[model samples]
Structures are given as structure tokens and as C-alpha cells.
Target: MDLHMNGGIGEASYASNSGLQRMGIMKTKGVIEQAVSDLCRNNVNFPKTLVMADLGCSSGPNTLLVGSMVINAVTNTSLEMGLKSPEVQINLNDLPTNDFNTIFIALQELQGNTTNGKMRDVHHQPSCYFTELDEVNKGNIYLSSTSPESVSRAYLEQFQKDFLGFLRCRSEELMAGGRMVLTLAGRTTDDPRVEESNRLWGPFALALQDMVFEGLVEEEKFDSFNLPQFTPSPTEIMNLVKMEGSFTIDHLEIFDVNWEAWKIMKNDNDASKMKEADDGVGHGVAKAIRAGIESLVANHFGEAILDDVFMRYGKCITDKRSNKENQSLVSITVSLTRKCDI
Candidate 1:
């Protein structure tokens, strides 16, 4: 799925439906804070003008939230050390089709006087894929426990190329000793198809299979659909960083969050109502997944079945939750520093 093209202000737009992603970002705030803190502390030649980029920074509140957090961290650290606060240059990057207008508007609202020097400049890069992959794997690469080894191998190869290329580009841009903090959905196990990794997609895929059975979507279409996502393990990420040879991993951590944890918390953390909340949690997770993947699914299965497909998926997730069979989603956060030039 072209995540940039698919997200905007529409009902299925990522901006309207990315609460789950925001929660993941929130979970990693401490890591981000520490990374910024370390950057200020360790770099004696810290730039008087700081340049920071948020990669894959999809639109909406989360985009600005990250920038603000980073800025706050740097500001606080500089104050603590009696250093001058640097002029910050924030670059929010995603795909060419991302709803940048929304981001710009939000920025204007947040910073009324751009000339006041709080933010120096905002540059948009229209084309930013660090590595390219074939679209042929579109519908055929579901990584379930029963998935073939060949599928897993192909996914890993693609990931390695993409990650290495990303690191190379960033290494060139970042000054020596600059720091970066990244957070993404990831797996705790090397095995990609384990329940923790595929908890959401497995049920969603089964929902599609049901549609094929009922003639709602063509079996051929179902057979060709593969999600354009990879959740790498910590070892894989470390290996890529070492192989790329441009950056050093300073810190890495993996954390588990229940699919329904955010939803439950939103409802005031009422443990006494656990039974009633189970179904809600299932539907909430299903909705989040739908917002993320609906664009790709609609592109393949026809937009006509969008609602029906999610309904089935929601029920499937609900059943799993009610049976206490669902697993928490795992997230990984990494802090890295550009290797000093020899």
C-alpha cells in the first residue's frame, strides 16, 4: 500500500485513524527523551542550528507530537547545561502523497509566528524511498506460522536492502556524532509468523479467507494479496546497523502492549468491567487495523467490500479476545549515533 497516498482527512485516512500509532509513539517517549538528552550531553560540537528529520512521519497529531517532544528534550537539556538553545530545523518526511497540507496547517496553528525563529524551515522531499522493491509480492506473502520459508526469506532480503539504504542516506546527512531515535512495530522473536507478530494480521487474513468462501471476493484476488509491512527482530536490526557500518546502536529496547490496552485505558481503566470490555477491545483493535490496511485491501478487493471485510475481521478479533487467545503487539525503539569520520 502507498501509505502516503492513502492517508489524509477521509474516513479511512491515517490522520483520522492512527490512535494506535500514537500510543506506540507515546510508549517510546522515554527512549526519545533519553536519546535527545544523550545527544546534547555527548556532542561537544553540537550544532548551533539543529537539523532533525522524522522519517515515515505520517500526518496527523503524532507527526507534530514527535517534533515537539524532541524540541522540548533538547530545550530542557540545553537549559540544564547552561547552553544556548539552538535554532531548530524540523523536517517532517513521509511519502510524496502524504497530507502535508494538514501538517503545515497544524504547524501554523501551533506556531503562530514562523518568523519568531522557533522553527527555521520546513522542507518537503517529494521522493524519498531509500530502497525499492517489486510490487509482485502484493497479495502472496502473508507470514503466518504455516507460511513457507521462501516467503520469509524474500521479506528479509527486501528489509535488509531497505534498511541499509536508509542508513546510508541518513549517515551522509547527519554530522558526526549526531543522534537518531527510531520506533517501529517489531517482533520479539526471530520467527516472523509467531502469534505476537501476526496477532492482528492473522485474524484479518482469516476474515478475507471467509470472504473468499462466501464469494464476496474472488479467491484469485485473495491469493495474490500480501501486506507491505515487515516487523523486524532486534537482532535483525542490530545486524543491519553493523553491516551498514555507518552508525552505532547506542540503545535498543522491545516493549509489549496489549492490543486493547489503549482502549481499556481510555474507558477509565475499569478492571471490574473486564468481561464487558473484552469485546470493545477486539473491535477497537480491528478498527485500528482497518484504518492502516483498508487502502491496500480496497485497491485489491474492490472498495465495495471494505465495510463487510472489516466487520468480519472485527468479529474474528472479538472471538479471539473473548476466548483470551490474543497476544500483545510488540514495539522496538532504537537509538543510534553517526560514526565519527576517521
Candidate 2:
């Protein structure tokens, strides 16, 4: 039940339906800028060639957005310091099923003679999760408030191993004093079962329950499926970094984003009109979730019900919004530097 984005530019493809994720990335641009600036300013032994990597970089417009920003930051900082911008080696890594070709095409379109002789060298690494875990939990529902202790323990153990492996690998690649900025969906509370951590999936599970009631999907299947995702709290992340002892956290910030923040509409002054627009915020969020997890769902529950399942999921989101429920997603961005003496 490995999860990957729906590829290419189709309706459900990550390319067409990742505005929420893009917004999250854009919100962390300040942190990324600060990290790059600090890396350049504090590391006097900085090499003439810079290497940067974007982990879990899915394809689409947002795919190359960060790289472009890094380049701009380096170039501007160099000018401010009366030095030349270093040659940048940018690496984009994601699951093998990701659309690297689409990303490469987008990169070509975006990087046409704009590197300013900085020697922009781009590389792509097709990989899955940094570490392996049990497949049963891959696409299943996450632990909720009522979940037993054993379930929570299993999930936490898996995350610990995966995250530690991830840090170890990056520690080997990054030079001493090199910086990395990472952004991911995260929970603000240490408790994994909090509403902020599982709200989106709670409604999604209800939708599947409805399907089970209607005999559209098997009850056993619905009960057994779980999402392979985990949203760590800032404390959890800090603990992992301390345990790994290879990277030091420079800055860690959490952001709260409304589910409706990604809506794109031309009628800025027409709230009523925008509410009735075809691509409402609720539907957009549902589409983004579907794009990320539909393949896994299809694999387990059969592809025939994907359309119905996501359609109901969208309605659930809309209903929640109408009821004035809190539908915010939490994001965590952390800046880290390799330990000089590690």
C-alpha cells in the first residue's frame, strides 16, 4: 500500500490538484530564505559549489519553486557580500512512481537562461520512504483518540525508525555546516490522537463507513485499511534529531493554515460568487487528499469506488465548513545544519 501521487496533468494528478501543498510550501519560504542566508553567512569555509536537496518533491508547478528561490537567495546574498554566486547542484527526490519526466520538463521551461552563469545542475532521485515499515499500516486509518495503546506504539515505533534513517542518510550527504530546510504536515500537540492530527481523516473514515453501510465497500476492508502517514509534533521531531546527534536544529516553526486558503478565483470582490465557484476550497482540499492517497485506496478497495469515495469526502468537508467546524491543517518547518564535529 505504498502511496504516491496520481501522476501527470489529469484532474486528480498532483500537478493539477496540489494547491494546498503549494500554499504550505510558499508559507515556509521565509524560513527557507533565512536558512540559506545563514548557511552563506556563517559558514566561512563554504565551497564554491553548493548542493541542495528537496526531499519528497512531487512534480508540478511547485516542484521547481523552491529551487528557484534558493538560487535567487544565493545570488542576492552573494551580491550583498561582494562575492560570486556558487554553482548550485539541486536534487529532487521522491518515490519511483513520481513523474520525474514532468518535473524535468517543468525545470527546463522554468530555468531557461535564468541561472545567471551559476551552473545550475539538477538531479533527480527516485526513492520511496527513507525506511521500510509494515505494509498493513501503509494505507490504513491512523490512530484516533479512541485507538488502543498498542496501535499508537506501533505507529510511533515505525516513525522513529524511518525518521532516524532519514537523518542518518542526510547526515552522510551534507557537508559540515551545510543547512537543510524541511517542511511537512505536522501536529502541534504531542498527542498523536488530537483532532488537529486526525481531523481530515476522521471525516474521510466516516465517508468510508457510509460506503460500508451501503455495501459499496467491505466493512472488513474499511476496518483494516490505514494511512501510512504520520504527522509529528515539534517535540517529537526535536527528540529524534537529538537522538540522531548528527544535525542541529537551527529553527523550528509551526503554521496553522485554513483548508479554504488554496482557492483560486478571479472574482476577488465577490464572496458569494466565489462560494458558488466550481472549484471551491472544500472540493480542492478533498481533491488534493485524493490525489495523494487514491492509488493506495484503489489498490485495497478496488478502483471502482474511488470516484464515489472522494465525492463523498468532498461533501463531508463542505458539510464541516458549513457547520463552522475548525478545519485547519498544521505544518511544521525545521531548519537544520550538519554538526561540524559529527
TM-score of each: 0.87, 0.91
Q: Which stretches of candidate 1 lie over 4 Å from their true place?
A: 5-11, 112-117, 128-141, 261-279, 323-325
Clashing pairs in 2: 138-228, 139-226, 139-227, 140-225, 140-226, 140-227, 141-225, 141-226
lDDT of 1 at 8: 59
Most accurate candidate by lDDT: 2
What is the C-alpha lDDT profile of model 1 across 134-242, one tens digit per residue? 4433333367777667677777887888888888989999988888888878998888877777777877887888887888888777766776678999999999999
lDDT of candidates 1 onward, in order? 0.73, 0.78
* Candidate 2 RMSD to the real structure: 3.6
Error of model 1, residue 330, in angstroms: 0.4
Candidate 2: deviation at residue 90, Å?
0.8
